[model samples]
Target: MPQTSKIFYQLKPLLQYVPSIEPPEKRVPLQDKLFWTLGCLLVFLVASQTGLYGIRIGDKTPDPWYWFRAVLASNRGTLMELGISPVVTSSLVMQLLIGSRLLHVDYSNKEDSALYTSAQKLCAIVITVGEALAYVVSGKMF
Candidate 1:
């Protein structure tokens, strides 16, 4: 096990309490899967168009992150402004760590795999909060 894996192992007790969906006991039908996929897509589209409650974008305000927004599939002043950035960032970071041997994970071991996933979730949550704070503090969301 790598050094970072040891650190993650220490967090196992807390990570176990993180909410997760259990695997389905039976195979899901194709129609049901399609329905859920479309439902989630609809929700995402709606969220992308939903403006933040207290934010108002002025027409003349310059967007410093305009190019970044396009790349991240984010909409300005909307609920989906962050898009999938946090999740993607966390995944990339985890991959980098593992590739560098900073973290060790055994894919064949259920416990190690679960811990790895839980760590990624925790990382994503932290990144999301940090990014939100940065945006607010930089006066970009005002």
Candidate 2:
């Protein structure tokens, strides 16, 4: 196992578990799936509009890349300021690393596969905090 993979396994224990939907007992109707998808989208949009608690007192600067926040699902000073940046960025890097063969992990192995997934989540979380701090430190956000 490479250093990165080992770190993921080690960190997994300390990370909070996000509850997700388990496998369904049977296939859902297409209409049901569509409604669920739409509902989730609505929720996401609403959340994005919501402001962050206790983060209302910040000097708003012109974001050079304000467009990315929407694409990344991040809202300024909101609960989702971290948005999906961490997950998307981490996944992208991991895919590239895996594709370039820089980090060797046998996808065929279950443990290795789990390690990769866990690593992605860990990397995202770390990135969320790092980016948040960077923004505040640089006076881009409060």
Give the TM-score (vs. native) of candidate 1.
Answer: 0.89
lDDT (0 to 1) per candidate = 0.87, 0.74
| Residue 78 C-alpha lDDT in model 2 | 71
For candidate 1, the 10 contiguous residues with the lowest summed lDDT are: 53-62
lDDT tens digits by residue: candidate 2, 50-101:
7866567254666665798779878777767778888888899889987887
State TM-scores per candidate.
0.89, 0.69
**What's the CA error at residue 2 for candidate 1, in Å?**
5.2
- The alpha-carbon root-mean-square deviation between model 2 and the true structure, to one decimal in Å, is 3.7
- Note the residue pairs that clash in candidate 1: none
- Residue-wise C-alpha lDDT for candidate 1, range 58-119, written one tens digit per residue: 45578888899888888888888898899999999999999988888999888899888998
